[model samples]
Target: MKSFKRKAKIYLPLLMVGAVIGLLFTNCSKQGFDAAVAEIQKGDDPFLGYAWHINNTGQSVFATSGSGVVGFDLNMLKAWTSGLSGSGLKIVVSDDGIQDAHEDLKDNFLYGVSINYHLSTPTGANNAPPNSVDDNHGTAVAGLIAAVGGNGVGTKGIAYKSKLIAYNLLSSNVAQLDERIGQQVTGGYDIYNMSWGSSQNNLPVPVAVWGTSLVAGVTNGRAGKGSIYVKSAGNDFIVKCHNSTTTYCVGNANFDPDNNMPYTLMTGALNSMGEVASYSSPGANLWVSSFGGEFGDDYPAMITTDRSGCSAGYAQTLNSGKVEFERGSDGNSKCNYTTTFNGTSAAAPVLAGAIALILEANPNLTWRDVKYILAKTAVQVSPNMSNVTRHPFYNYPGDASKNVRLPTGAIWENAWVTNAAGFKFHNWFGFGRVNVDAAVALARNYSSPYTAGPSVIGFLMNSSPSPNAIPDYDAAGISSTLSVGTSLRIEAVQVQINISHNNIADLGIELISPSGTKSMIVNMRNSLTGIAGFDNDIFLSNAFFHERSNGTWTLKVYDGASNDITGTLNSWGVKIIGTP
Candidate 1:
């Protein structure tokens, strides 16, 4: 029996946490953060609220609808925001509430609701949240998509001139199940972000609100219907995010059933260093990873925001220049800047924000086009970064193997000698990181009939982001640069990111600049690739800013959220082009 247990432990690490039964990952805040707490942002501190700090700022977050935005390095996000200003073209941001009310959000917002959140009863508003208790998730998500542009007081987002919408979903049980079908079919939303999760314990009365609604929405959206669904990577240590309740069919290997719309895109998360987050489930059904903070020794790798008015106000007291962390769950709050997290809830917004930037570049893009560009234009990463890298919060606690980088070629079979750095395509990095340069180049060089922006390969995001800010790269720090009209066109901005498994979308996505300011760009729901396009087409774009400083470009992937997008990627190619 002992031998069997030993073998199970050894082989099961690569599989789902279920194979060996896993514990809940880090408590969302203090896992490996004993070393980086003093660097917390004290609200409104220039360059202080980067991705390492945790502040929800009363916004409706993208993935899984959580609170608090982890802060990033200030300088890093500057590069991310600099490229946002442009003329003739207005950037459009996606939101859950359909109404972005952040202090910095832009005026116009693109609204759309997820099918699941729609009311099933014939006599109801079909509100996504199904309550009057201000589900900040929707507002939080809108804030990430498009906060005020050119606003220097707060953090910056991926796009400057954009709008948002509540895109309501229903959490309460309604009377008519047909309402579910009607909401999905009628809501003319461009992209819908779904950060919530399910395992069956909630016992949803089988209605139009099933997983199929997402597929239908994506199908219609990608087909130029201005409808797409950005789902979160289920927060599970299993194959299909199958927690104790929900059971995913894709894990069955024989999941070859049919559906109305198989066009859903899911996302996952990575750490501050661009590697998969420790708590990040697996790369199985994941799609991409966005910067979720992870900078400085004094702070943890996190995506920061102004969470002063959020539900977990206790954890976000220091946001927007206030002290709130001092309090415990009992209500007493503590005031500090640095914070930590672990889940897909954090990663989804990042990808969504990137897409918003791409949309800014070309307003005529469709959901299908967005998927195409993502998969086809991505950077390759180390092989076992996904399988070998254990979830720091749950696995390898006190185990020496957790910190060790695997030998070259150990992850993939017959890996190239140059791959000694451990870079490859797999669950760890779905086609590697998103190449902002390639994507822009494609938009500039190509003239495809399907897509608009120079045949742009994909959205914003770079390959490598770090060095400017060692250890944790809150925002891109020294890793990236933004050229309004100096280098790349203002309408053309991109970030470095890893499109990993479509899971862990709860982690927040952030952007920081040189001055130490920051912003939450996309939610975990937005980080997934609607399709699995090709990999490597360097011709997308690359810039050499003659008047730019040498900054380390970094893309932090959040570790949260997931959906059937894993299967979606395998079936469809990542497309870029769609208006939210």
Candidate 2:
């Protein structure tokens, strides 16, 4: 409706794999190894082909200011972040509650909540105790979600316009965390990163009430104006098949991917092999996978910041300094301390951070809108792969229906994008790999049926206005400007005929816009509201009107059903008869 999006260069995070370094060399080499440019690897990883997308694409469009996280492409991240920063968004961090703010957070945090109970007496702010040890996790989470870029320091974030409002929500006890969330319905954080989910071994409620609270936090976030809660789909790593809420750590108590719930997103971890990590949780409810390769499964180059002392389990960070994760921080003989780590917990926040970047770019997006953009925007690793591959036994009469083909990946005879072996939507790989270009394109190309004008709007009644409507119209018929805007929907219904019109029933009404752009108003199936009585009228059902953006409009009604089809307009009444 309005071009208000912050200029954003959404850069995806550098790919981290716990797999063999040799594989990294191989994957990296695949770029130089491209003889014909295989589609399997779009190779948008800039390091291989073009210079970092930051310098190549959107440097001019955006101000190159700050950065933030988002579940999208790095090049797009470069574009998305720079643009948003140009739009004036700062950064904030929520490192282990109020007082224990870390370096990545300190001055960056925003205080959207002002509850007095948590405020420090002297400072007039909620200066909670500086539980430093556990602050690393939150700081790391902060960095990934909204790290400032181009400072010659750390990596940049996905969105530059996003500002952080860090409020640590981890509790020493799950119940307390849940209660606190209940109190902080607005959850303070525009993006709540719950990196830690209790093991099913520990069950305090019939179902995980904490997970419920997290979802509730997202709901409240929507109410709070603009917020998106991203939670790690837990580290259980099981094939979560059914959707149920049983007594124990219920198996199917999750959203169905085939039937996604209204709100909330659950992600899985993609190991370097591009296969679902054995440790990654699975089910029809799974949305997408983030990089969380097991130690040595992909990039062993990562450093998980240890926040053993803070209350909120962790805030993801760059494994460094006073806030570094020591080799022996676990206080146990079995801590498995190494740079190589694998857990859905590690991947979820990265995805969540990306969501934050998206929200920053488009603050008007509702949770549903956000979900739609993300899903619709994701580019399947292999756009032609399938999810399930049925063997010959499962084949009926040995025929496959294109309409009923399995999802993007995992198909019987993979023939969509041939030569590009492998199904992308396998049970393991949700919907191919997350392609940044595809996702952002989806967002940019999105055009909802938002009404552009108000009542009494003029329907120019012409394909392209001319001397017939306006004098001296055109030398090049393809391009012309009439009124220059489509609004004030010319309200009414008229008859429309089919393309197969060797018959006399060829009748219809043209919905000409103020700009002379025409959309035909025809009779069709009347399904729902604001549409029951106007079956044959110009319908604005999908018209997602921008609150107060639609301007005045006009309509040119005509007779098409059973008449000469030329005279039902009220232009004179709307203002055409010399002030009559």
Candidate 3:
């Protein structure tokens, strides 16, 4: 939430300014944009128009598909014509595996730097190519990031000219995965696109090494300019809540602890109609959002490279539930491309590609500069949505006679709040949907104030006040206050809690900044709702970014479920990363 001091409310005007600057700087005219669009319309790729993420004009992507909302795209046409196609940048796709020779992706693949960790030596020509249908993920993910463009090929990528390095970390050991995120054997990559997450929710993974790597990458990778790490906020919004057939959503972006890291830029998803995707998980940790269409069967989805040929992949001839394009019943007889790739998986790479374009615009920009540009230029969607609603856990099972409703009767979701720094944030969409055109324009003129960036071992303060008993099914939660003496601007905040409870999901945890900005880092009724509580588990939030850290900070934990069992707030600590 670093204050850009720019008028972010004038979003459309900012976009126009970006377009004008891009056109003027590249010496391209509006006719150039039109000519590029006309070339695509004349069938340069035969499917570019269907790729609504690049430029949405409400055209159906497949035979039986419905159209998306007009103008709800990445607005990349101007950026593309302005000579920003992510040239000279390198991206790492850490996932299952990739079809390196796929028609749409082969041209951009970086052979020498890629790795196949499943192999004995873990490096060579066979750099983790797809071995089965299950291994088709990385190929699609790669296509979203760097599939070749305007080559009279299949579809265009967001960063068409960016080089890609593939890694089969999904099939490798955890140590190798940790290395990929941290200091790699070949360690000069620019952006790391991670579309994977932990299956275990509300449980701590061994992220200490990965967390250290993330800090190092942002501070020291890419020749000291810092490497950008883009990750997918999980795709579990529609999952069933704990111990119930009812499909109540309990997914939060912070559930996967990897996303909680300040260095990790987590992105949520937007569907074809320019709304939050039904399956996109929501939390305070999300930085921004990008397109991840609905299932391609009924609506348009991402069109990207799949496994080679019809022998395997989602586009295989015999694959079930595929759309017209994927089944090869249409023009895709080779079955090389699939139109069914969708999720935060797709959304994350979209942001990564956008980051690539920003870097290409100005490679001198630091990691923090890139983040500031994005936050400054993001477009707020669903602006009219109410900021307060009846709390989701207000009606949880609790003895009416013994437990009373929480006094603060509302929960904040889908609502925008302008922090003290004049930066607006929302739980559903952090800053808002990324405006690539505006972001690129800002990046071109941006300079980093944080020349050295935040240190790896951030400033930490702990509060181990005497344990307090949390009321059962009551709104009156126990609160602990800590007075801080450190004076520094905030970049991100992390809170580690040790709580003892029968059912963890029944609890809600929030951090109230000295500025009175209340951020619910962990929500109630998550996947761990019926599980035992955590001890010393850490959660992070970006809601207080750019705010001062020299005031009183408060921690509140409450139980929402009606049960005889109660929980104890054992101890909690805080860590803040930013400038002094």
Top candidate when judged by lDDT against the true structure: 3
Task: Give me the overall lDDT of model 1.
Answer: 0.33
Writing each residue's lDDT as its tens digit, candidate 1 over 1-580 gives 0000101111111122322322222223332232232343333433223333122222111112122223211112332434643222222222223323334543444323223244453222322332333333444444444444444444444433544444343322222234433353344454455544432111122234544555455445434435545544534333323242222211210011111122444554544433444334333223444433322122233433323343332134333422223222212222111233234444555556566555555556666556556555655444433332222222333544323222222221111111111222343333444544455445444454342322222343333333222112111212243322112111112332333333422222333322222222222322222323212211100111011211322223332222322211111111122221
Kindly list the per-residue Cα lDDT of model 2 for residues 345-407, writing each as its tens digit: 556555665665565556656554555465445445334444224321132333332112221
| Candidate 2 segments whose C-alpha is farther than 4 A from its true place | 1-82, 85-101, 111-135, 171-177, 181-185, 200-226, 238-261, 296-298, 301-342, 381-432, 449-580
TM-score of each: 0.48, 0.46, 0.86
Runs in model 1 with CA error above 4 Å?
Answer: 1-49, 52-100, 106-134, 170-186, 200-226, 238-262, 293-301, 304-342, 384-424, 447-580
Residue 173, candidate 2: how far off, in angstroms?
A: 6.6
User: When superposed on Cα atoms, how far off is each prediction in RMSD?
Assistant: 16.9, 18.5, 9.1
Q: Candidate 1's error at 480, in angstroms?
A: 48
* lDDT assessment of candidate 2: 0.33
The superposed Cα distance between candidate 3 and the true structure at residue 141, in angstroms, equals 0.7
Per residue, candidate 3 scores C-alpha lDDT tens digits across 450-486 of 7554742233445456547888866667788887778
Q: lDDT-based ranking, best first?
A: 3, 1, 2
lDDT of each: 0.33, 0.33, 0.71
